[model samples]
Target: MSDQSRLGLINENPIQNGLDAFRALFTSICTSRNLPSTIDTLRQLGVEDLRNLALTLFTSLRNLPVSGSLHSTSGSATLRSVLLRLITAVASDSFDFDRIKPLLEIAISENTQDAQIWDFVSTAAAESTPPPRSIASSLQQTPCSQNTSSFVNSSEYRQNVDPVLKLELEHLYVGLPNFHKSFFGDIPELDMVSEAVFRKCTEGDSPLFKEGWSGWPAGAKESDVLTWIGGLISQLEAFADNRIPTSAARRKLLAQPKTPLEGSTGKRSMDIGFVDSDIIYKPDTTDSRYRWAHILVVGELKSNPKADIASAAWIDLARYAREVLAAQDTRRFVLGFTLCGSLMRVWEFDRLGGIASEQFDINKEEGGLQFVATILGFLRMNEEMLGFDPTIVTTSGQKYIKIERNGQTECLIIDEVIKRAPCIAGRATTCWKAHRNDDPHNPLVIKDSWQYVDRDEEGELLQEATEKGVTNVARYYHHETVRIRTDDDVRNNVRKGLDVTKATNFQPKRTLPSNVGGTVSRISRQGRSSSSGVKRPSSETDAALPPSKRSYSASPTKPNLDVLSNRIHRRVVLRDYGEAIYKASSRAALLDALEGCI
Candidate 1:
């Protein structure tokens, strides 16, 4: 029969079909007394047929009588061995063991008297075929001081970043800044612009006022909005040049619209990019595009006011922030804005999560001042205030991170970046292969990550382990928690003026039945902290019942608040350990390394 017809026949009555097939195989085995031939016959069946047969056998074994005659027979021993081998073959042929693991456990539990059969099956099914070579052996054979170019080109080094789930985005970016308070109070550059200059730039006949600032007209395009905002920033710069002394004047920045940013490997283009004027006009071959490294601020524009937490515009904004953070090694955080119609919201993205100011109408007098302040603030801010790490500096065209150990200073020349966190939030760990200025022959690993403030420092743990003579651990050199000029941790500096209480829970968009009433009944799982009670749809019993019928006695009294953990920046230098263990040259080598670790 054809594969399709055979699959249909099994689907019609899987249990009966499985029993008949097994009976035929058993009869053949009895007649010939040849297990190899019987096993070969079973292999001829399709992958789908084998899966159905396995499930059917598991079910039948679960229901089998405990006092059956087959349990006492010598032939049953042979049959059980064959069954174990068959399941192992299925798993090796690409069947997902995790999908059927629960079912296997259930079958084993139901037939507790047949312990040997279940134990053998479990062991055989879990065994995977070993590769020819192990990663540990390969690393041992290779020299640690080898050039990094070869390692960079290896397939093992090209690990892709995991895609962020939609649910995670909702949870990470829910905190809203107070609408009345300015988010840029720390920026002293805003003081340079007097009330007269601010009024002149935003009042009647200004770029913003002329572009429907009072209210955006229906069907207004994003391109027109970008032009208006760009013109306003230019006017601000023009005024700053004439009023401020030459020594006090800040470097000029240009607001370009619909420009494709270079440096990032991603092909997506930005709606608007605020970039340094000097680098933007440089005589380079990039054709007027700004590199993501040089971009001071990123902007997104939407024709409509649907740029909510769940909207595509917000997702794109998050993606752009990730690209910028990845491109600039020293960047601590990212500043971005989304203009939805005439409404504007400024956002800050860091290793923990994202925070945003409440939307404001830019056409009004008060909102116009807020808009200009944001633009001018970004323009006049120094390198440190723009989110670049001050300790990491470029001297004579080479990037180096200054390290002070035992009151003596040294520089770690950054040779190559090995890994960077793929997401915008969470512990953004970055690894770099570097060497000290005096010792260029021996390279070291410099690891940087945003660790949780409450957890024990990794550097301390490593130091303790080394002092106690722990084997197979990376040799620790130096470690420090990065601090700002004000002597506060980087995490504390970024969270100023943000109110976590005002944050709202992310409600996924789902269509409900017409008969369903009130909000969807969501219950928080037990053991979750009261401060952030994350809720989700309940168990199967609750799913079968209507929303109103579902019991919510376990729900918390206070509404769920989307709060993020506070993380402090930490950097550690370690002795170069070669490539990862997965690159082992032989199975024995890999096994040996794993055995040592255990």
Candidate 2:
């Protein structure tokens, strides 16, 4: 009797439960005695079903949460055998390497040090009598020092085996950067090194490029293209900033993988995260030390047009934008770009405005160098302005910049309009009881510095906004937006507009700057501090759900305002003392000048 029969899972009545079904499939295909029967069963399902089943098996391995480690997992032995058989089956039939190779890596990733798994994969690859005609032809034309036997024997040296992937694997195992580069000995500068490579690839002089005008080699594997694109971007990184990496070196810089809140314990692993043009911009802060990096720009590079990959790439970009918005309370301009040799497309994602994309030929005028330069400009801005150490407070507060002139100290607070009523179709500004330092007792109860963007009477967009009718403004600006305009602008405007002596004599500064750049400078203060009971939610939950469903608020319930007001009172006393000191300095200065005359 078959194992299935013994288990009471007959051919007609299979295991109904998902978990049991997978376990049954695993045991049946993995045992040596039942391997032929399993293959025959797959054959009965036809070639298409077998191909799909092969893919499903790979996905199952990826999604399965292994306990302890891959080796220690209960069914790991069965999984290993099943994977080996799948590789043998695919290679023997000359199945698409693009699909098969990624699946093989799933096994390699589980236990990278396992020599048996590597041996099986390499041996199966070698036993394949004939590769696809396109691959065979390309390989025949390509010049290599090693013969076919040697090529198949050395896994690392195989043309299809990506060195960068090996670098990623090595780093994943050991905390080393660019570990694979050690194998290459020494190479010249990329500009000089890439010239020969570029010529060979473009001219079809080397077998790496297909005949006529195909961008890459005939039957070029996905890894081959990704490795090439990664190399290309690595060269471009030198022109941009050394800290911003574009290759496997870039992946190393990412914060340790975080578990998603949606209950998927496995870390996020997307193609864009590895090889796509996306650049992750991390804030330079030691305050919150979870080395999370934000996706500033999403760029995808393709050698050939695969609609599925392209669509998936865009979805990844969109997902990245949402995650960034949830983490930081600033406006961000998430950019997207795709390059397929001469063809290029540009995209932008605006939280309120929606996303837009434009496509053009990079080889044509107004595209090539300009497009590259624009992206580099974005990278430069993200590194410098957006990626600064930010001050995070649990409660609503205003950052005060203290300025002094001739011993007369002036604490400049940007005055903002608090919209008592919400705007007709825009965001609302709320009253913020800013704490004196972190002390809620000394509150400088004030309005947010937000100015509405309005269209002119002509219905055209207005460069300058008027405060008369406008009430709403963006609640927060992303770090990227903060870089463009800063809180200093508010200070500069107030200082320049008023004659300090006259403004002091007539009245205290009533209104702060309506809008300030997001950057807040550090200032020192002394007082007992209290924080609001508000906490930002994790991005994982926000990422999984839609914009409408996700909650960004720290607290689900309303805050006690009466208690807030009393706590805010202490901070006000500190502000009063500061103002008194400024007045005393002015009087003392006047007395000193009189004494000098006498």
Candidate 3:
């Protein structure tokens, strides 16, 4: 068709002429070969128009008819290539382009016709502009460095992240449940630290009050505020130590202000951390001082009390939580808090995501008591209450995991950690090479991962495979869904008086075109276990599980509004087998291993 005819078609039936209109615009840009003119044309289009045009073009490219003529396919490929280049040229800091790039990249990667287009566009775009600042870069100017993996640090990580993994994290973050009360509600610890303790500590005659906090001066620096808070915590810690002599054995939770925690590079540091007093920290030395394992709780401080959850302070807190969780393998969750001036909120982060307490001001008597209770609660918590998995124990410099089967118990000594999940909020799978305490020579593999409550256990599938006489598969010994008191308590605490109508709806507003579909089918194939022959539940059944499992009996309101996915901790033991194929001694050995597996 002529250009005039294409334009006429677009004007006559804009909705129906989706592909044709896209083709015409694409052809004009390609034929003109004028970057400035193309940019001008793009500038003239409204943001919505640009978005709709990009979506329509992507949809057409992705859903091209299989039975179409070769010429038509070739034409589509050429059009796609030109459009990608055009997008690269015009890509900027604009909201519309930012949204379009990721979706366009997804389409290009899925399309086999022009798989190289992504790399070409990426390189071209990089040459055009300074690389976009990542979430990490934005916070680099802070007093302490927070950079860890590119996954948390840089925007470049987004380009390479597995789509399913990205989706999973997004789901967890969006559905992350937050509670209005403290993690420990009205515990004996609160009563132990009476309101009198707070009043006495901050009284006009007290040393802490002389330093600050009696009339906490306006425009006080964060460091000064932190020092004043530290004094109160220290007084409480000392009081606990005197009352409960055994508390000393658990190690003193000392507040370290502006000190870099040991784990990652020394550059990354938290504003304040509660660390064990037993460790001799040399802050002036080049080496890392306080280990993440020794750190009990992390805190972020902001001079501005108005800093909300969306502020950079909270973002930094979230990043610190991930770092702490990643560093401590035994940790099931991380406890943190944000002190934005006098406003304080405690946070708990697990694989499901984060839950935050309602913010309370520390300047008031009630808030001061709550603050004292919070510190006392931290001190009173046992190892389990602090989010440690009791089933995994350390004794005599050896780590052991207790696995139970049919009401019988067996201990496995963990020898080597084979793998650990890199991210904080997903399955967080960890694998270990272990041996039964009774039979020390033979090795077994223990796999620990978090699974959705409704999903089938891996042990069941392995048992099925063994029963069916499947060859070359590991033998299943035991599996258990781990039940931790803290997890249950967290759920129960959050569910109390939770009004579903007040919950924020995080479901995405835009849906992929029907023909284009989603990544579910692709993820299923990638996520399948080696025992692929094992039958699994249908998609309809899988779809039904979330709603049914997420529903709360207490709430008559819409349950879907509170959409957090509750994941159960699971561990399975299997007979050790072949090594990683790449670890084979020779190429021939690798081929033999592969053949046996096939």
Candidate scoring better on TM-score of 1 and 2? 1
Indicate which candidate wins on lDDT.
1
Tens digits of per-residue lDDT for model 3, 489-548: 224432333322233434444221222111111111111111122111111011100000
> What does candidate 1's lDDT look like per residue over 1-598, in tens digits?
3445433433443332323333433344335444443434454444443343453354233223321212212223322323323333342345454444443333323233343433434343345212122234323322111011111211110011111122224344453755223445655546547344566655665444544353344554866665566566677777655654454325444444444567654343567756665664544665656677777777777777765544345655766777788788788888888777767778777775666777777776776777777777777666766678887888887888988888999889998888775556656678889999999998889898876666578898888888898888988888998767543343356666465556554344322111212121222111121111111111100111111112111113212212434668888989755666878998999888889788
Backbone collision count in every prediction? 8, 21, 1
Candidate 2 regions off by >4 Å? 1-223, 238-270, 273-292, 300-312, 339-343, 361-375, 382-598
Task: Enumerate residue pairs that collide in model 3.
Answer: 145-268
Each prediction's RMSD over C-alphas, in Å, is 16.8, 26.8, 14.5
lDDT of each: 0.53, 0.29, 0.51
Range of the 10 consecutive residues with the lowest summed lDDT in candidate 2: 563-572
The TM-score-based order of candidates, best leading, equals 3, 1, 2
Looking at model 1, residue 113 earns an lDDT score of 30
Candidate 2 C-alpha lDDT tens digits along 541-583: 1100001101111111311111001000001101211222335
Off-target runs (Cα >4 Å) in candidate 1 are 1-165, 172-183, 189-194, 202-218, 243-260, 281-289, 486-491, 504-564, 580-598
- Predicted structure 1: lDDT: 0.53
Itemize residue pairs with steric clashes in candidate 1: 133-585, 133-586, 134-584, 134-585, 134-586, 135-583, 135-584, 213-363
